[model samples]
Target: MHVPDGFIDAPTSLAAGAVAAAAVAVSLRGARRELDERTAPLAGLVAAFIFAVQMLNFPVAAGTSGHLLGGALAAILVGPYTGVLCVSVVLLMQGILFADGGLTALGVNITDMAVVTTVVSYAVFRGLVKVLPRRRRSVTVASFVAALVSVPAAAVAFTLIYAVGGTTDVSIGKVATAMVGVHVLIGIGEAAITGLTVGAVVAVRPDLVYGARDLRQRLKLRVNGELIDAPAPAAAPVAARTSRRALWISGLVTSLVLAGFVSFYASSSPDGLEKVAADQGIDKRTEKHASADSPLADYGVRDIADARLSGGLAGVIGVGATAVAGTGVFWAVRRRRTGDVSPTAVENV
Candidate 1:
């Protein structure tokens, strides 16, 4: 959820900011290992796709709504570290460009939405994928379960953060109960979206999926009295698969269509966090966003009276900007990985 300003006090917010910064720093380093020709390109598209799906907030309860948090989907498609960065990028774009999340509370939002969700979901996904049958279906199953659990995990994380720095004097127990309860419903939506998206990608190109990598039961051959692991595939086919330009183009187009048009039908209700905040008096101390005056504030362009066109255009802009920003960040990380290799090092024949 996008935490607005004044929800958390200065000290706690600063602490959370430090935590978010550290998490991003660590993820940047970890992504170096995860990013490659295949993943590096798709990582940006994943971010954009996440940004698009988040716009389609589905009804979760009587008044509350939910959207794809993207941590599980991204981690399954790309990698955990990159997943965190993807959500972080979306949050940044929303806060600064759309005025959806508060600028001052950016750290709190990132910690709650980006770091916690990615860590918890990816951990669950990895654990499950290891134990389950090593198949595409198993990967999808793990995605659903991981995403289902992650939404409530994020809610719990927010409650913990609020318990420490909530501006209002609401009962912490009540807040926790309400937060977790509503988000549990939201988690179902998250799970469905994650499962479908991950399944689709894994079906088309398992090679592009980071979580599916090495997930296939390694082949074995009977040789002389022993079963030995099969040799790795030739480099040429592998290289060909890595250049997933078609998949990349398809993903980008899908993102554009989702954000540009499909978002218009999304439920126009308070999301899980907003509903909980309003019900729990968490917004009593809420302050106006600094970017509220921006042209693209509130996911609409200034002076564009046509709500559909304005919001659609803003969504397109957001998707484009996020894709570019995310791509740049990941590309640099990939380059950093290559740069670390000494020029004099010999390549394995």
Candidate 2:
């Protein structure tokens, strides 16, 4: 959920800002180990895809809706560190460009939505995969369960943050109950979307899925009545041609379609957090976004007569901007890391 400005007190916001900064710093370092020749480019596509899917808010309850948090989905497709960065990139873009999230409360949103969800979901996913059968289907199953849990975890995190710095005099107990209740329904939707997406990717090219990378069946060779491990086969030529370029183009196109077209049919109901805030009196002190007057504010172009055209153009612009920004950040990280791991650096090490 995107926490708006004035929901949290200044001191608490600053503290959360420090925490968010530290998390981003750590993720940047860790992403160096995650990104490589094949995965670095997909990282950008993952961010853009998350941004697009987030635009399509599905109805969760009679008057509430929820969208893809994308933490688990990104982590399963890429890696956890990069997944955090991916969601963070989407949050930053939405805040500054679309005024979807508040600028002053950026840290709070990142901590609650990006950091907490990624950390919790990835941990749960890895743990489940370890115990479950090491198969492609198992990866999909674990992804569904992990995504199901992450939404409530983020809801709880926000509740705690509000308990500490909530501007209104609301009952924390009631707030927590309502927040968790609605988000639990939202989590089911999250699980379905995540499972299907991960399954699709794993089916097309299991190699591209970082979370499923370790899911390999050890072949046994009956050598002289003794079973031993068989040597790994070389990469097939056809499989070698299955690069990220095709996947990247396909993902980008899918993102464009979802944001530019399908988003128009998305439920207009308030999302889980917005509904909870309104019901719990948590929105009593909510402040207006600083960029509320921006041309692209509220995901619509300024002075565009047609609602469909204006919103569509804004969505397209957002997808493009987020993709470029994410690509730039990831590319820089990859380049810097590659330079460090060159022959000279290896010798020095």
Candidate 3:
């Protein structure tokens, strides 16, 4: 949920800003370990895909809607640290470019949506993967449960933050009940999206999925009435490896289609947080976005009256910008890891 300005007081916002900054700093360091050769590339794609899916808000209740939070999906597809950066990038882009989330409340949104969701989902996902059957299905199952819990966890986090700094004098208990209750429905939708997306990626390129690394069951073979593990396949030639270029291109194209075209059909209702805020009077002091005058404010171009074309163009731009920004961050993290691993660097002369 994108928290607008004036919802939280200045002191609380500043405190949250410090917390967000610290969380991002820690993630940047941890991402070096997560963004290796294989995962670095997928991390960018995960960000782009999350941006696309988030555009498609599905109906959750009569007036409330939900969208992909992307923490669980990203953590399952890439890694937890990188996943936090991924969602943070999307939130940043939305705040600066689309003017959806408020600039002043950026820290609140990042802390609740990016940090809390990623940390909670990944922790639960890893725990479940440890106890559940070590299979591809287990990864998907863990993703579902992780995503399901993460939404409510985020809601709870926001409720607590509001209790401390809410501008209005609303009942904290009522606000918590309303927020958690609506988000629980939203969590089901989150679970399905996370499960399906993680399943699809794991099926296609289990090698690309970081969370599935330990779930690779060895292929069993019957050798003279005895069970034996099959030998691992040799690495493909460079030419054979180049064939995956098409897959990457296809994935980018699909992201564009989802964001640029499919997003037009998404529900037009307010999301879980917006609905709850309106119902609970938490939004009574909400302020307009500082960037509301931007050309691309609210995911539409300035003068393009055609709703479809304006929205589509905005979506395309969002996907392109998010992919580039995410790739740059991940590439930098990967390179830093390489530099740290060098002999001279490690030895410190």
Candidate 4:
């Protein structure tokens, strides 16, 4: 959930900011290992896709809705470190460009949404992948379960944060009850989305899916009453066409549909956190976003009379911008990694 300003005190926000900064720093370093030629470009698309889908909040309860946190989906499709970066990029974009999440509370949102969700989901996913049958189905199953748990985990994290630095004197029990309750319903949606998306990617390009990489066990066959491993499939030649044009185009189209068109049909009610805050009096101390005056504030362009057209245009712009920014960052990271590994650079150093 997007935590607005004034929900947490200044000192707590600063502390969370330090934590978020440290996490982002660590992720940047770890992402060096995760980013490669094949995945570097896809990582950006994943971030933009997450940003767009999050705009489509689904109904969870009578007055509460929830959106994709994207941690599990990112971690399964990309890698944990890169997943954190993907989500952080989306949060940063939303705060500065869309005025959706508060700038002052950026650290809190990053910590709860980006760091906690990615770490928890990836840990659970890895653990499941270790124990379950090593198959594509297991990867999908793990993605589903990991996503299901990450939402409540984030809710618990927020509850704890509120308990420590809550601006209002709401009952912790009530906050936890409401937060966990509605988020659990939201987690179901998250699980389904994560499963379906991960399954689709694993089907088309299992090579691109980080979580399913090791699941590609060699085929086995019985010959002359003895079991023998079958020969590996011919590896796609490095020179073979390696174009993601189709995937990127399809992903952008899907993002546009979800954010521009489908979002209109999404629940008009507040999301899980917003509903809890309103119900528990947490909103009593909430502050406005720092970028509230931005042209794209509230996901609409300034002076746009047609709600549908304005929202759709904003969605398309956001998707394109996010993809470009994310791809640029990932490509830079990949380039740096390549340079570091280059023989000339290694020798020069």
Residue pairs in candidate 4 whose N, alpha carbon or C atoms collide under 3 angstroms: none
Better of 1 and 3 by TM-score: 1
- What is the C-alpha local distance difference test score of each model? 0.90, 0.91, 0.88, 0.89
> Considering every candidate listed, which one attains the maximal lDDT?
2
Better of 1 and 3 by lDDT: 1
Which number leads on TM-score?
Answer: 1
Clashes of each: 0, 0, 0, 0
TM-score for each predicted model, relative to the true structure:
0.94, 0.93, 0.92, 0.92
Models sorted by lDDT, best on top: 2, 1, 4, 3
Tens digit per residue, CA lDDT, model 4, 1-349: 9999999999999999999999998998888888776788899999999998998889888878899999999988989999999999999999999998778889999999999999999999999999999888899999999999999999999999999998999899999999999999999999999999999888777878999989677688999999898864445554333435567678878987877777767778899999999888999987778899989998888899998888887887788888888999889887887777875543332
Instruction: For model 2, state the Cα shift of residue 60 in Å.
Output: 0.9
Off by over 4 Å in 3: 217-240, 343-349
Per-residue lDDT of model 3, residues 195-252, tens digit only: 9988987887777788998967779999999999886555556753564455567778
> Which stretches of model 4 miss by more than 4 angstroms?
217-243, 343-349
Q: Cα deviation of 21 in candidate 4 (Å)?
A: 0.6
Give the Å error, residue 180, model 2. Answer: 0.3
Report RMSD (Å) for each prediction in the order shown. 2.4, 3.1, 4.2, 4.1
Q: What TM-score does candidate 4 get on C-alpha atoms?
A: 0.92
Weakest 10 consecutive residues of candidate 1 by summed lDDT = 340-349
